[model samples]
Target: MVSSSLFNRASKVFPGGVNSPVRYYTPEPIYFARAKGTKLLDEEGKEYLDFSMGFGAVFTGYANSDILDTQMEIFANPVPEGVVNEKEIILGEMINEAVPSMEMMRFTNSGTEATMHAIRLARAFTGRDIIVKMNGGFHGAHDYVLIGAGSGAATFGTPTSPGIPEEIGKTVLVGEFNHRESLEQIFEKHGNNIAAVIVEPIMGNMGVILPEPCFLEFLRDITEAHGALLIFDEVITGFRFRYGAYQDMIGIRPDLTTMGKIIGGGLPVGVFGGREEIMKNISPQGKVYQSGTFSANPYTMATGIATLEYLKKIDYQSTIRLACWIEDKLKPYEDMGLKVNRAYNMFTPFFNQQRVWDYPSAVASDSLKFMTFFRGLLKHGIYLSPGQFETSFVGPAHSPESVEMAAFKMVYTLENEMNESGNA
Candidate 1:
């Protein structure tokens, strides 16, 4: 039997016995002892291929040799007090150089911090009160952005968390993901009072929902016409989909952008950047204030610099080709009455027959069927995210061999699930 002792001890200390609610499982959670490359070993020593990738943070993969070496080098020499370290400077310069819109960048501890600061900056810059967000998009656990979380939040069917005050929640306005008309209506009514419109650009949190054609351009046009700032929450899509920002691929630029995941090279890091005139509104330049003691620590900076250096030399088209291969293998599952959707290296296999477009469609996926598929994949030594609403990630470590293995496991799991459901 799996151990419940760690969870039992943890429950009394941490709320839900996990640092984040998404990590919690229904029957029991497996405790991982160690992880390397694309695999993780549980406490009981069972090995499974890991597609979670620390919730899409480990783009280069776990325990990368170059990142490890950089970490060691930073630890060997402590930086002098009151002096800015070279690693931090280099990482900042790399971001600004690669992403054209980022004239100035500020680091934060997590994506939540980056987004929270971005919203504040928008409010400060535009002098407006209301903020707009996509219906199923998740920015972070912060009150403003938590208006509509996708998986665990959607599983419970309460998109809005309980602790967030209704008064504070009222400041947030929700719009459909790809529906331009819904956003237009919201802007038509509250356009004058709106300060910023924050979006995922590619909605990874809601199971890799790609924005409708010209959807991002529409946001840019609307926000600019209304004198509000557009903020692309590229925490997941930043470095993974492309070299800099996914916006570059979309061919539209937001006034401000928030980034996370691959930026830290697996360490905890977040950053928000945009034009210099708008960025200068932040503290030390203007009144809007944000600060963190360990925002640009040497350890994370070293790892980030090393990761970017390696990423700069690699070919993105080759990585995208691998993603297409995985998607092609799973495409036949539609014949089994399952709806499989994918974008770049992120993909999802929904149990329902209908195409998932918005929050309602995403939640309409059969939960029981998904649970069985998830458990079967786990038994077959392939690890998927515990919740169906979460996207399964592929990275540099996931070779074509591993993708084939995962495809076989998925096919077997789907067949078994269909047989059990009397639909085979």
Candidate 2:
């Protein structure tokens, strides 16, 4: 009744009773009144083990004292806009040190703006128009990325949304994530006019789909061969598995890269950068123009640096160990003929028996049964994203007790499912 009443009031104001389309479920989205380390207290006073983790933005956990203190200090002496802030340079230096491919960078208010700018830079630098994106890759909500979008768009069955003009939509080409021939076919046809191929190196929006062997390497070589820039949208994967960008570990350096989520330290922020020659195309330096009022403001700069500093000292290996342990426990489910795709600290359990490697196969996973699985987790006080296409994250803050409780709940739920199907 608490969340229901809140939804009733919210629906009158916000569309679908939520600000974000992904936040809305069938009955209503539950409201979390407060959050702490690895937990969310709902409007009804029920506490949930938060597996969603702020859509992968929260790496250091909720209400982190270091980040909060940084924010407070910045608030005490407010940051100025329309002028150069020293903290932006400091943050930029830290990011460049971590991800060496970004020789120069620019900040934006959101990943949408970052990707938009990156695409524009690519087009200007290469003197081309058409861009390529993975079929299920979600760069952001902008018109260039919304075509065949995954996550919320895939969950709602509207891969391509309305309102994007045909002229704009036709320029963006879509190809499968792990499928090689699909991209080869696209490049074979539109090689000359293709400005860039933007991809998520490791797909996050479509439930942690991993890139196949040499898939990323192929993108780099092919884009170079066709005189097109390769952009890696590491918005979700920036620091999910390591201290640096995933591309660093994978040994692939993109021409341009867009980063968000963990880099912002839970603030509204985004950054895009690459080789100096390419990034030079962004305004005041080159023809492509980009400017934002809130981009790299002192507040975000301070907290972002603080978070990255904290992450440097933390052990990411701990998260990998914990995630692998959970995967080991869930491995029995695969023996029982179910699919659970995982990569490091991120994973998703599909409700179908078939494998999911691309957008079409991912879409085929049973959404209704996944919702049932979602409700079962909710009953046991585990909160994951409601959409099947979204990835569930595990952070450094998660405790053994929470994992035990969650594991028990998962096995119990699946046992009930098998019984229902007369396979127990």
Candidate 3:
């Protein structure tokens, strides 16, 4: 009742009663009272085993003691935004050291800013206008990224959102996730006009899709051949699988890399960096302009440092173990005509029978039935990502017991309660 009432009040001010489109649902989104690790307690005092994990931002888990300690230190010191701080320098060094391709980098307020600036930097450095993005790949909410986004934007019923000038869309080219010929055709035609090919090496916003073998290497080679920069958008995938960027694991160094989410330690942050010759193009060195009052704020930098420090010592295999346990339990989902796609610890149960490898396949999932299962799980004290297009993450925060309980409830719901009629 309190959550319902809060939603009613919020509706009067915020559009759709939510700041983010993915946060809204039919009955009304539940307001969280508090969160710790993989648990979220609602205003109604209902506890949920959280599989969303701050939409893949809370890598080390929510309300972590180390992050809390950093908060306390910031409070005692009263570090304000819009100042150069030693903490920022330390965080920059940590990221550059982890992802060697990022010889130099710049921090921003959000992933959108990072990608927007990266696109501009690429254009300025190359003196070309076109940016090619994968069909389902989501860089951020900026205009160029939103043009050809997949399921994430599809939640709002449009892959190419309105209000963007027609000319802006012309600057971006769309390519298939795993298919190589799509890129071949695009570059063959517009290679000279292309400033960069911005892509998500491992797609996350369109659910967890891994790259095909040699696909990334091909991207590296083709971009170099055409004189275009290769940019890896690691907003969600940066540290999701390992301590470093995904490009490093694949042995391909992108000309630029954009990162956020986990690197921020549950705080708002974004970073874009690459080879020294290219990064120097950003303002204070070259002409491309990018600045924010919150950029390199002390709080986020200190919190990130604490998170990386904690991350260095923990065993990431724990997350994989949890995923494997749920995968075994959810084998019944396949029997129910659903497919679960996983990349390391992040996974999604698509309402499609075939394996999902790209944007087209991801879009084919039965979203209506997914909402039915989603509602059923919610009633059973589980909080998954609200859309079929979104991903469910397991981190150090999730325990085996919580995952087991969630799996059992999910199975029970699919077996006895599901209608496939969109009726919860």
User: Which candidate comes out best when scored by TM-score?
Assistant: 3
lDDT of 2 by residue, 1-424 (tens): 8889999999999988888898888777788899998899998899999889889898789988878898898999887876898999999999999999999999998999999999989998988988888887999999888876323311211237778776676677777788888778788888899999999988888787888899999999999999999999999989778898999998999999999989988898899999999988788988789999889988889989999988888888887777676677777887565577888888888766777777888888877767777877787798887778988888888877787778777888777754432111
Candidate 3 lDDT over 36-99, as tens digits, reads 8888999989998899988999988888886788878887997766878789999999998999
**TM-scores, all models, native as reference:** 0.94, 0.95, 0.96
- The residue-by-residue lDDT of candidate 1 on 262-343, one tens digit each, is 9999999999999899999999898999998888877788889999988887677666676677677777877665776777
* Poorly placed runs, candidate 1 (over 4 Å): 80-83, 148-159, 418-424
Question: Which ten residues in a row are the worst by lDDT in model 1?
Answer: 149-158
lDDT of each: 0.82, 0.85, 0.86
Model 2, position 138: C-alpha lDDT score: 90
| TM-score result, candidate 3 | 0.96
Better TM-score candidate (2, 3): 3
- Top candidate on lDDT is 3
Better of 1 and 3 by TM-score: 3
